[model samples]
Structure formats: C-alpha cells, structure tokens
Target chain A: MTPRVRVPETGYNFAYLDEATKRMIRRALLKAVAIPGYQVPFAAREMPMPYGWGTGGVQVTAAILGRNDVLKVIDQGSDDTTNAVSIRAFFARTAGVAVTTRTRDATVIQTRHRIPEAPLAEGQVLVYQVPIPEPLRFLEPRETETRQLHALAEYGPMHVKLYEDIARHGHIATTYAYPVEVAGRYVMDPSPTPKFDNPKMDDCPALQLFGAGREKRIYAVPPYTRVRSLDFEDHPFRVQHFDRPCALCGAGDVYLDEVLTDDAGGRMFVCSDTDHCEARREAGHRGEGA
Target chain B: MALARGFADPVHDAQGAFRAMLDALARPGLVQALPAALAPPAPLTSELAAIALALADADAPVWLDGPLAEAPEVEEFLRFHTGARLVADPAEAAFALVADPEACPDFSAFAQGSPAYPDRSTTLVLAVRHLAAGEGLAFEGPGIRGRVRLGVAPLPAGFAARWSANHALFPRGIDLLLAAPGRVAGLPRTARLLEA
Candidate 1:
C-alpha cells in the first residue's frame, strides 16, 4: 500500500492566494514571456508583508507554484537570513509544499539581490523581487517620457548617462543592478543584484521572472534568451573580484561578502550563497576558520 | 445540459496545466504534453480545453471561430469551468480560441495591444492537427538555444507571411499557443521563423 500524503489544514487558500488572482498573474506572466524583457502591468495584490519585503516575489511564486514544487527562498544569497526564512515559512504553512535549501533541488527559487552560485536547470524558475522595474526611472522621472522612449526605441539618453559615468570616473562607476538589453530589444534592469550575476542572465537555461509590487509591473526573460550588459567597446562590462577565497567554504570563483568579525580590522570574506557554502563544507572543503 | 466534467482536484490540475503552458511559452517550439482531460465537442481538443481552464476567467473575454464556436457543449464547459465571456469580435478578445487553423481569422483581426501596454494583446490558441518536429519552419529567438524546428500541419496558405508581418510589429502582436491532441507548443511574437 502507498503511504498517504498529509493534507495541509491551513485556513489560507493554496499558496495563500486565490485562484482568480493567480489566474490574473499567470495571464500577465504569459504576456511577459511572449515579449521577453518588456514589463507588463499587473493587478498588484497586497500581501501580509510590506512592499519592500518581497511581496512581489511572493505573489509571483504563489501563482506559479504547484503542490509538488520544491521552493527555495533567499535574501542576499543566504537561505538562513531573516527575510528568506520568513517567506519560506509562509509558503510552507500555506502551500504545504516541500522547501529545500539546495539550489539544484528547488523547482522554484524566490530571490532578493542574488542568483544562486549553482547554475539553474531548464525546468527551474527564478523569481526576482524587484524594487524598481524601470532602468530609466532615474534618468527620466516621468513615466510618459520613458514609455515614449521605449516605443520609439530611443535609447540614446541611456548611453549618454553611461558615457557621463566614464567622463566623471576613470571607469564605469556603477557596480550593482547593471542594465542589460534583452533579445536585442527592450532594456531591462535585472533587479539590484550585484553586477557579478548579470552574466548569468544571458542565455541561461532557466526562466527568469521579475515582479515589482509597488510598481505594479511584471517582466520575464525566457530560457536561452540573449541578455547583453550595457557597456562600451573601450570600457567593457566586468564583475567584482576578491583577492582571497571564502573564509567559510574556500570558494574562489563564487561571489563573496566581507564580514567584519570584530570592531577591529579583523575581517573575513565568506561565500554569500549559504547553500553553496554548506554544500562545500559537507564535501570536506574547509577555509580559514577550520 | 449535462454538467461539464472538470478537473477532479481544481488546484492541482490547474497548476499542472499552467506549468505546462508556462514551459511551452518560455521555450518556444518545444512540445509539452498536457493532461488529457475534458473531451469537448467537435474541433476543440483536450489540450486546448485544459489551457482555457487554466488561463481563462470571467475577467477575460474569449473569441471563438469554426465549428467549436457553435458547439453548445464547448460553450457550456467554458462557462461552467472558466466563466469566460464569449465575444463576437476578435479584436476585443483577451484570448481567442481557433477551432480550425485553416479557417482561422487573419492575425491582424486580434488585438495587438498598444505601444504603452503591449501585454494587453490577445493570445491566440490555435487547434492544429499535429504539433511535432521535423520538416517545417525553423525558429530562432529568445527561447531557442541555436535553432528549433516546429512542423504545424493544416495551417492557412498565408500563415508564414502573416507571421512575419505580425513579428514585424515587435513588442506588439498576438502571441500564439498551438495545440494538437495532447501536446501544446508556443510561438510568441519574439520567435522568428527562419527560412526552411
């Protein structure tokens, strides 16, 4: 006899959102996929948490997640962080779905500020919590001007802004949330993730979705899509690097976060990806502490 | 009218169908198998019905063509399960269900959305005789790795030309979902049909 599965007794609906709202989001998501990197307006729903606390990612995850889906939540690349734990627990209680910290095992991963160190597969989806969906917001304060710019394919102003960066600083000064051109068309902001993860957005096997709750917008980059980071021939786009390996897992290639152990100048660099670090440690990889 | 048979478990079944549709859309020209549920009247395949159930709601107006539009069973099923309102005009439809690809209306008849809000365009769900890979139009776009081929049978004479015209619209054209028997494939406006 097969073992019976336990049913969730949570009062909330499946995934904690109504089917109507899910259908609405799913419709927007389909449009987002169709137009690759073009932001689609959605009926942004209010969540228990505030706007900046990943309400957008939560809504997107709720719409796409199934009962069998393995969910993974991350904040600043760590699964153990407060935001990650809170969102993961919210889904676990409402959806009664299995949650995994392993990037390889997760079918749906909701992230804020980082992509996983491990490469995502074809079937997996990465939901990004975007605070601002528009790359031109800072340049043009008015939505009317930006919409006209996109319609006319007038991206000269964007290039001018980047050129100004070179004029002011010796190199392109912008470090995180680098803008990218998608499918040779729309220019998209890949959330606030450090520029290190921008390359991972290009021609990736997994689908990437961005949702902004406050902005009431949703966008997507389908699998195998061309995403080129904005740069000039003289000053090419580059990622941040570290002179030393991770202090916890000894990962040299992955993105690292500098952690100050004490008030003194005693600081250690560690892998920002908690799952990657834990996996490395389990595999007998040790760092300065060990 | 007989009570139309719907998914036994609404949440799980709809989620399953939605995921398949999502995969199909994300990876254009890839044929994804859908659940064979609710065998509707003439012209409407099980795959199309499943998609309609998953994506359609009362908020979305649907446009239907061919014999399937006249079939009461199809109407009843959509009304009961999806609560989608049927519209006579294709342009006004949020989703258009085409029974026969050969007799389907011109691509321009449906909503291509606006310059400001391109996502408001209509999604055309065309019921094809077969959705497979082999000799047909080659596809290269966002979802495609190098190139993927999709062979859609019984298409109208001017489909390729119309598709090119539609694609030229860019960021503003109807997205397509092709269904055959138990499998479905996507052809978003971004997908370009290369010369065979």
Candidate 2:
C-alpha cells in the first residue's frame, strides 16, 4: 500500500518550510487581514511539493495554524479527493491539528475549485489555491500596463474581452474561476469556482483568502465584504450550471459537477462538496449516492 | 558531490537567500553578499550566480531573460540542480534574472502588484558590478528610518517612466534586487527614489 503520509523525520516541518517561513507567511496573513482584499507579495518558499498543488494554501495554513484551530481541505469541493486527502494528511502530521471533512466544524478550510454549500461563519477562514492571480494578465500582456490600469481603475479592456467572447460564442465561455471586483478595491479571481458560487461571496460572514503560490501573491476578502462582477448593462451576468438537480443529493440548487454515468451520454449530477452531501445523507436526505 | 547537510541540495540556496533579500529590501541599499557558494562563467559574477541559486527553484514558473543561455555552464547548472520551469517569454517569469541590468528586459512586461493586492508583483534580480554608498538616487519609504543613497546604473530607456506608472499603482509594481559578488540591495514596490 502506498503510504499516505510523507513528512520527513526532522530538520523542517512535514512541508519542509521552516518556522521563519511560517512566520513570514503569518506576517503576510496579518497584513492580508488588515488590508482586506489586498494581495500581499511574499518571498514564497519552495515546498518539496510541486506548484499548482496547494503550495500557496499550505503556506497560508501553516502560517496561521495554532494549537487549537481545526483544519479541513477540499479539492473540487470534495474532501476525499486524492489531492485533498494528501494535503489534509500533511497538516495532520506537521501541525498535529484535528482534520475533519465537515465544513461546519473546520476553522480553516483550504480549498480548490468550490466553497462549501454550508454557510461559512465569521470565526472561520477559507483559503483558496489560485493558479493565476491576475484577471487582467491575459488581456494586458505587460504587468506594467495592468498595474496602471488597476491604479486608474480602468477595466475597459476586461469588459471588452468578455463582450468579444460573448459576441463570438453566444455565451461567455468561462466555465469556472470567473473574476470579480472585491470590496470595491481589487478585481479578484474566486479561484476556479463556477459562477454558481459567486453570489455566495457577497457580505459573507467568513473571511476568504486567496493564495497563488506560483504567482507569489496572498490576497483576502474580509467577512461582510462587497464583491461585484464586471458586466455591461446590455450583457448582464449569468451563472453557469447544468439544468439537472444533484443525482445523489437530489438537491436542485447545489453546484453540480456533471458526472458521466452511462455510455450513451446519460449522466448524473452530484454535490461537489462531499461533506455537505454526507451530512445531508445522515440527516435522511439521499439523492442516489453511488 | 558532497550533499548539503540539511537541505536537499546546495542550490536549494533560495531557502537562505530569501532572508538576505528581505533584509536588503527592509534596510534599503544596505549591501550584503549571498551566503551560498557558486561559480559562474565569464560575464556572470559569482554574486549574481548565488542570487539565482538562492531565488530560483524547481517550481518557479518561467520568465527567463538575459544571459542565461549566453552562459551555458550556468544554464546547465540551473537545470541540473534546480528543476526550474524555463519560461521562454519574459512576460511569463515569476522571477526574472539578469546578469547585467544594462541589458535587462523591459520592466513593463513583468507582473506588477494588482490594485487590491499590490503585492502580487514580480521580482527582478540583476547581477551588477560594484555596490557603493554613493550613486543612484536617495530613497525613503515603509522600511527605511530616513533617507539613504546607493550607487547603481541609471534606468534603461523608458525604464523610470514606466516604473513611475508601476509606482503609481502603489501596493502593486515590481520589486528589484541588485546583487554583486557577495552583496545585495532591494527596491521594494513600497520604496520610492527621492530625486536630488
């Protein structure tokens, strides 16, 4: 059997970053909380792990972890996914913190793709792993230009790009990880979550943190923050999703990950967050758990 | 090769070089050489090599410009020792390394900090000739207690003007580091050059 745990015996923590690194990340986290939605550049250390693999989220979690905080990790909104399992196990060994799949119970939920269906409370912190932190990076090839645009609050080019896409494709082809304006100051990427989850961000009671390790940025949107998606009056915003309800939970409102069930294009929909689904199941709600 | 006692490899030097980089920025023009030992080919200073070894890692994504290929030994050493991703375009790099700032890439093409989170900027590490107490412009900002001066080359054509645009973004903009044989200096986005 492949050993699920892989932390070394000594020298560095299970992740290999030293206490100083965690302290630096901690300092950045404090600043992130203080500024609210401002992305803080940190001297990100290289983990034994690869990039795009929760390095940023791990750094944030490692920095803020104390003796009491409960930690949870999810990928594609499921805690049992291979990547989620790996990261959760990492924190368990290094920080020795309790790990739970239940969203309601976790103090720190390090996630990729989707946020929990259960409401995040004020005391809780949600950390997201970001592949690319910049929304304007694609539109403006130069960081120098994008900075100027953001400084000037000039998002004309972004609106143009989205409008052009709609004109050509009849719909904005963006499936997940759509961008949004945060707390009226920064245009932020809500990780890769489908737009179905975008509405959940407004005035949220819980603090949301975004980390892009490869990009070396740590930004946050505090609890009860304001977020708006950039859209023209002629082309209003619409969330993306399949027309079907969750096949397992039978819930019509949840964000559904289209699951292929048969060869003839027959498929099933399920709650992306497994913990919430499991909780619902125990509470006498079951769609068709396969 | 004698394996580094604690770290996986000696080239994992970025682990230590980061603190020095931090100090250089936190202190402003305060010169301190790198700790790791490295050798570079002609036109590349050992100081510059150390900075690269200290900053670049396997997971660093792209944005390679300047004399990396010009010095084949340095290139091979980096690839062999550090599994760093080679980004062909300067526009793509997380850390942009230059042996000589005189021929550095345009600062505009790199990642500047975004408005809401001006810290998402890219860091440019250039290998320069000597670092002295005189030269360049005076500086003051978040970290410095008062004003300080340092010696260095003038910005390339369109450099300072574009940088002014970057600076205007405040919390966003590129951070620069100038390294010599054993010393380094930082120019964080929060810092500004006071014209004499």
Candidate 3:
C-alpha cells in the first residue's frame, strides 16, 4: 500500500487539484451544506476529465479527500462498470489513496446513481455526480425564471407537472430523477438515480454533496436532514418494485435491475447495488442462480 | 516574531480544518473542534485561523474588522500563507473576519450577493466568547432536525431582529462561522431564529 501522505505518487498535487482550487470548492461545499437542497454556484475548474463523466463528483471528492481516506466510485450501482472503473482508477493514480469496492470500507464514495444498500456511517461523505442540479429546469427553461421561483418558493409548477403526469397516466409516471423537497423548504433534484434510491436519502447519516461541473452547481444534504420525495395525498410517491428477488444474491428488499438473458423474453433480476450483492453472496446468501 | 504561523503540515492541516468547517457548517448550532489549535494574534482564535487557512485563497478577498484588522501580524500571516488579499471594503470581501461581534458592521454591510448567484455572498468568521446551547436562541432549518437552542454571549444588541431580517434575504445573505477558542459553530442564512 502507498503511504497515506499529502503528496500523491502520481506527481499530482493532492487529489490532482491545486490547493487554491480545493479551497474554493471547499468553501462552496460549506455553503451548500448550510443551505441544504439549495444549489450553490461554484467556480467549476477545468479538470483533466470531461464535464459529464463524473467530473463534478470527482472535483467534490478531490476537494474533501484527505491522505487517509479510502475512496470508492460506483456508476449506476456497479463498481465494475466502465465509468466507475475509470473514476476509481483516476483517483488511485492521482490521489494515491486506498480504493475499495466495499461500501463499508470506503470513507468517501462518489457515485453516479443508486445509493448503496448498506447504510452509510456518520463520518462518511457521499459525493453524487449531478448532470442537472435544477429541479425546475425542465418546467422553466430560463435560469432567471427558476432562480425567481426558488426564491419565491413557488414550487406549484413542479406539483402541477407531477399532477399532470397522474392525469396523463394512472399514476405519477416520473420514475428516475424524481424531485424531492429538502428540509421542507427547497425542492431538489436527487440526480438521475432511480426513484428506488430516493428513499435512502431521507434522514441519511452521511453528508451528501451533489456537484454539477457543466452546470457549475454544488448542493448538499447534511446528515439527519429531512428529505421528502415530492408527492400528494391522492398520488403518493412509491418506489419501483420487482416481483422476483435478485436471481444471483436473493436480495428481495434491495433495488433490482432486470436484465435480459437471451434474445427471447428470458430475463433475470439482480441487485442494482453490486457491492451489496457481492457482500450478501460472500455471506452465504443464495438464489436460483447459485 | 509573527504572532501566528501557518499550519505545520499544510496539506494535512488544511484538509483537517476543511473537514471540521464542513461538518460545523453542514450542521448548524453544533460546535465542532478544530484539529490543530494555534494561537493567532489577539482576538482571532486558532479556530478562525484554521478556517481562513482552509477556505480562503489568493483568488478571494478577505476583510478583517476591529482588533483583528489592527493586528499587522494577522494580515502578514494570512497574506504570506494563504495568499489571500485583504480588502478594506466589506462588500468586496468574499470572507470577513470579525474579532468582536458587537463592534461588527451591520449584516447588510457585507456582500449579500446577487439573486442569480447566492454563493457570492460573504462568509463572516467572527470571534465569540461563548458558543454553546442553553437559553439564548432557537434554530430551526435545514440542518436542525426539530429545533436546536444555541447560546452565543456578547452578541450585538438586537441581533435576533438583525438575523431575522438577514434570514428574510434567504439565498442572498451572509453566512456566519462563530469561533470560540478551539470550538466553532455556523449559522447559515436558512437557519430560522425562532422567537421566544
């Protein structure tokens, strides 16, 4: 193992960013945390990587990362996914920090979507890569309009859109990128994570930071902060359910992704959270596939 | 000799300070301790020094008020270490250091930021005599679960009313970090000061 020192072995200044840049991001992060669910605009620097591909989360992680931290990166719930693998490798090379796929082992976890099934501890920091931080962007295209709306707390349009979804479909058809109200004040877009991962955000133990590099936005949900998915009495918010348990790990309660086995209708359910699945399997969890 | 020096371990110390400030600001009314306590010049505690080192950089302008401003060593230490430019006008400062809250300027005197960019507002790092929970003020907002009582002694008179008006500004208002010796507490614009 590389010595957990300030200087990275890769010759990059700690975490691949300069001290000034880190301080700037850290200041924004502090503000972001203070005003939970409010998107704080930051001077998003031009990182080595592109904007959409976890740059925001990477910047956030870089700013907060210490020499002793164990880092983890997951893309769409899978640690081995292409995006996840690259991000994990990037940090390993630049930060020279210990990298882990296990949720329990990681002190800082940067994820694209799907919160880990294993509950996060108090000190852990969860950095989320957000493509669009604005929850009202789709409804109100103009940034000025959205800013005003947020200031006035006029989230009636958001409710109207969801209400319309119910009117069009039998229920609120919005599944991914579901809007949630943080601290009963600011309506926040909890990234594009499956609505299944939405409930995990409520009163969570770990500090949650959302970063959008292209959007130059940073927001946070501090530990134990109240976060409620936007919904009404008539049309309550519900997570997606699978009839069958995970075919590999037998996780019935965990979020599952349905994968087609063949060209035919043959398919199988698997835990969306790969770390959770692997841990359960190692612990003697069994399923039909086993 | 310079009264206060920079962190012994720049990388590690700054990281630790950043994390502590992050935790403190994230959870308002909760007093988080600084990792390393260094005695700065008069009025400025080690906690505030640690914060300024962690947050301020060459790109940002910081304002010092009262005795903290009068102390040349504090300015020299910050300039030499963090490379932060000290500004005279509070409105131009990205960060403001206040040794005495009672002698501090009105909350509106600092940059409240524009409607488009709320993050542009100044963050006040004030030296306080007391930073604990008791009977002073009740805080309820994003960070606070139900309501958390915070007591900060020697706060300027009519601070509650001032804070209420500041809170009314919402997205465009100054955030505060109250530093007392090794402990620090934050009061964001969102935190509502409930009336007694």
Best of the candidates, TM-score: 1
| Better model by DockQ: candidate 2 vs candidate 3 | 3
Q: In model 1, which runs have C-alpha deviations exceeding 4 angstroms?
A: A1-6
Q: Rank the candidates by DockQ, best first.
A: 1, 3, 2
Tens digit of per-residue lDDT, candidate 1, span A190-250: 9999999999999999999999999989999999999999999999998998898999888
DockQ, candidate no. 2: 0.04
User: Top lDDT: which candidate number?
Assistant: 1
Listed per model in order, the count of residue pairs whose N, CA or C atoms clash below 3 Å is 0, 16, 0
Instruction: For residues A1-290, write the lDDT of model 2, one tens digit per residue.
Output: 12323333454553446655654564465345434455677878786579989888888777655545678899998888888988887777765667788888888899998889999985687889988877888888887787677667787887788888799998676767777887566677788788888888777767677888888988777565567876768677787656776777777778877788789998777988888877777887767654
Give the worst 10-residue stretch by lDDT in candidate 3 chain B.
Answer: B35-44
Candidate that beats the other on DockQ, 1 or 2, i.e. the better one: 1
Q: How many backbone clashes does candidate 1 have?
A: 0
TM-score leaderboard ranking: 1, 3, 2
Clashing pairs in 1: none
Model 3 chain A worst lDDT window (10 residues):
A1-10
lDDT of each: 0.89, 0.68, 0.86
